[model samples]
Target: MKNIYDLIIEDSEKFKDYFLNDEDHPLRYFPKFNSINIIVGANNCGKSRFMRQLMSLNSYDGINDLLLIRELIDEYNLYVEMFNIDKIQTFIDKYSRNIAGGTILDQKAVKIQKNRLIKLKEGDFKNIISVINGNKKKLDEMLGYSGMQDDFLKDYSKIEDTYSKEFKPKKYYIPTLRTAHSLFQIIKHGSEKKLDVPGTNDYEKIEKDIFLHTYLQNYRIDKSVQIFTGLHLYRDILNSRNSEKSIRIQFENFEKFLSVNFFDSKQIDIVAKFDKNDNEKGINESELILIHVEGEKETRKLYDLGDGVQALIVLMYKIFMSEPESFIFIDEPELNLHPGMQRLFLEQITSNKDLINKKLKYIISTHSNHFLDLTIEKEDVSIYLFSQRKNELNDKQFIVKNVNRGDNSLLKDLGVNNSSVFMANCSIWVEGISDRNYLKAFLKSYCDSIGKSYPKEDIDFAFFEYAGSNIDHYIFEDEVEKEDVEIVLKDIKALAISNRIFLLADCDASKQSSKKGIRLKELEDAKTDNFIPKIVWNIREVENLLTNEMWKEILIELCNKTLVKSHEAEILLKIDKALSEVNYSDFAKKYVGEFLEEIRKKMGKISSRFILNRSAYEVKSEESFGTIINKRELSELVFNKNFSWEILSRNNEIEQLTIEIYNFITQKQ
Candidate 1:
């Protein structure tokens, strides 16, 4: 599977020659394995481009791909039509303005006068009659017309306020209509043409092409492939007859045909069927029967099966079996499938580990985190974030970064406080389940005590859990543009209601750095690897004070606790009792002092824990307080006085993030 990376396309510049602005350029550095990835983003953010590029690598084709190509072609044609109409309209408007009122002269009658008296010549007679019968009766009478003149002015006077007089066709109407009709005639004929190749007759030629180019060029056609495509159309059924009741396979004319029963074969014959009344009816009402072929005798109407079942069969028979080693792109595989079915399909794909490695891989783009959660452990899997950045000129640039590779640091950059339902706006990303659960419980208890009506179910957060501790490993894209991040934030920022958006992270320490206050050296050491250090050196300096006097008693009781006591105690259950519990009575007596000291000493330090009276939603970082990330970090820091704040200083976006988190927390349904 690692050999998949043998073709690295890191230099994107080379692709610039192939398309307009290097369209559909691909990255050379992709994960190595026979695995599937789900690309997610807002529409038109290059997901399709990437998938198409991948498919081009192996020339995969199936119903989905064909459908996508058709849709794209349709869209392109629409664009061309729109452009053509806009150009024509603009030209007509410009020309009409220049020639306004010019067409009215053609319908007007010219006067025929030579020596003060009018002589009615052949053309002048028509004009003279028009003057007397049309709207010029007064002028005709003044010219001495003998017969009684008609009331020519009764209805017509160019219809005041109406612009119809200025209207005129630039050319003959039928000629233009004929040209347009001719243009569409090609479309009507081309629609019947085989998708990729031109001038090919029926499905047999397509099947033969698929076989010759794909599987059969190297080998002979087998019974399975023959039967699978043979029954695609109904016409092929009647021309050939089978000796037995077994599933009969026949290739008649240009159609692929297969049938089960003798009566079914007759049904497949494309002729119109007569009802009891014997009137000719359209064939649209006929039933389409598909043989499952999985067992001895099972035939079902095509419409009877669920969409997911149909999709599964089509994909398995048409794509999986036919297009080997090609990129299989799926958009939301969860669509129309039950959870059990989803799991079943996932397991089925995962179980074919060898086939997956040898001749198959997939790039499935989706918005469902549930689908992502199912495949967290695949080594070939990675996550990418679409992010955006705004320039000084107010222009936006979009970026796609590999979150797994630590390229852009999305979770850190965005400062999303991911929670669920209540903290619905929070970008709560967790490295493990323990942290996720603990943070949830801690938030629930803290909000409850604040008298803020914090319903456990009302906590608004979007918790994204990763299986591993390394945050960078989750990134899927290599480089993300700033515009991309902003586009993503546009959606995320909408969820915020007023809670401080905090990225609450934890720092684990070994015995050497077991002190309460985080040392500057420890902070540096934690940042050395591919991980972001959570320890705040400045905050820990103040936290260390408790270790000698107040913390000794608190630490001792916490370490030796034999029974669960308080909410904090229960929440920290996973923390070995030896490392994290305290006697409730003692904690209450000393808690006030610790909180007081935090307020006084850690007030303005960039790396110290301070007490935040407001929750995550209410906190905002002003110039005097800090940045967005800083304000957010302050709120999370306030929750635990013993935690250091050095890590918070490194993130400049904390203040804005804090306000975002707070707003998210307080937001209602």
Candidate 2:
């Protein structure tokens, strides 16, 4: 008759003694239950095993009874051996005196012991005792009792039951939908052959059978239902005159749940149809149907609804009607639900005032990000992430870790590939496509020079291009009425809470009227711990970082492929003249004075006469310097193995920037 809390305390004390004497016990800590707990992991990390352990403790069947008895017996023997008790008389005297004195033992203790002894007498232990009769002396000596066999036989059946009471607080397990559907088929076909009991052979089947049995026992509406069909549950609820108002309220709430969140234009009602006349088989037929009436159109049965809708209905019913303080284990509630529905379903359950008042506890195992994301902001929820580690023997050992808020590695522990922007450890927000190209090319070449692998998976870096240099979109808030400098730093600090963020901006000092370099100074002034914001220090634009030699190499390749054979030298001379004027300082100047004007005239004359037979001005105006030097092609060339890092290293500013980026990604915070 002890409550679950008292039983847990008793078990904990016993386990503490056991672990103190045996230091290498695998389980270092017992799982602590919470109002709501989540277990998340990849395919096989013992998540289901953990849930089954809880189920075993909550429900007592034959296998569990035997295991508990064995455990108690083992503990009893350990106590006897530790105290060096050598006679049956001594132990029995102590047990009897403890009961009579009303000191350490109470009536409940005697009753529990008697119950256990009675079970042993009626069960298989008689055969076990008979098999050991030939070695009675040896068994007696092992038990530290000279007449153990006769003593046990004389005391067991004579102990009477002090009271008849059952344990309170039951367990309910809703297995995965696939398993539930399979069990339904088994019940419908009347193939209720007993499966192997748990703690015996065929552990998986036994575990599934236990879950199915527990769910049916907890939710069965009528004893004569034959199978736990939805119709039976509906009929029981509708026909209960004592709780008519409560049942109607439940149905109305469910209808609201469907209408507000699922179907906007549909009204739902539960109806039952019965045939008064018996057929030739002498059976009166009855059925329960959930009707959904769409606006001015047609009505359909609930079974005609999608699988997701049906699943939600069944899931919600269980949650609403479950007893207070009950333990519920749901495996993969996200099975048939879409991502949005998954979020909504969890939200409804967690926020339901009635369910909250009931003090029910929920343990869910899932692989859905949507489900886990819902738990992040809820303070009462506990998240356990399971993973597998390979031991020296090359076997997978399961490990479970409790995930806390502000754990930056949460996404990584969930087995999310960091190549995704949402999960990346380090995210670089760039100004445009060209800026992305430049960073990627530089990172590839730098890693190659250092003899390290590029695009490393562990410290994944994701590059996102904002539409413009104004990066307020990536910033967390707009209410901080600070200067632009503080705004950028605040954005970086905010992002660094969940991820490592960096801003790559162009050093637009040449524009004279631009505020491009202000954010970098602000970042330096703020001195945030984990944010890395930098400007392109070596050049005016990202395109300016392209070395003149690389640019010439690209142009020569383009000219060889495009110009006619006879005017190759003429085209090469014109390209050289154009390149000489296009230095970093004047690249964005829009006008280059008389020196470029003369080169333009010569290029115009040559192009007008021969190349492609097009107008000279048309050819000259169509191809700007940026267009001719394709950023994509230039980036590919930079990542090539044979490309000169020696030449790139000459720009100390770029080299320093690359080293900073490498350190930011590789070093731990």
Alpha carbon lDDT of each predicted model = 0.34, 0.50
lDDT of 2 by residue, 1-669 (tens): 111110121122222222211233333333333467888878887777666554554221111123333544464445444543443334344446655765533333222242121112212332323323323454455454463423222111111223643334445666673321212221121334344432221111111344435546764422221222232344544563236676656556666666655564246555544434324222234233446555635655555678777777667766666555566777888888765567566766666556776566777898777566666544467777777665577865566666664455666656666443244467676776556656666775676586554543213665656655445434533235556776566445356334666667666543323454555555444434456777555455555565555555544443333453667787777667666765534443232122233344434544345332222112344443222234444454444323456766666766777777777777543
Largest TM-score belongs to which candidate?
A: 2
Candidate 2 stretches with Cα past 4 Å from truth are: 1-24, 28-32, 58-167, 178-248, 263-267, 272-288, 292-297, 389-397, 406-414, 418-669
lDDT by residue (50-80, candidate 1, tens digit) is 5434433311111112222234334433533
Candidate that scores best on lDDT? 2
Task: In model 2, state the lDDT of residue 51.
Answer: 65
Residue pairs in collision within model 2? none
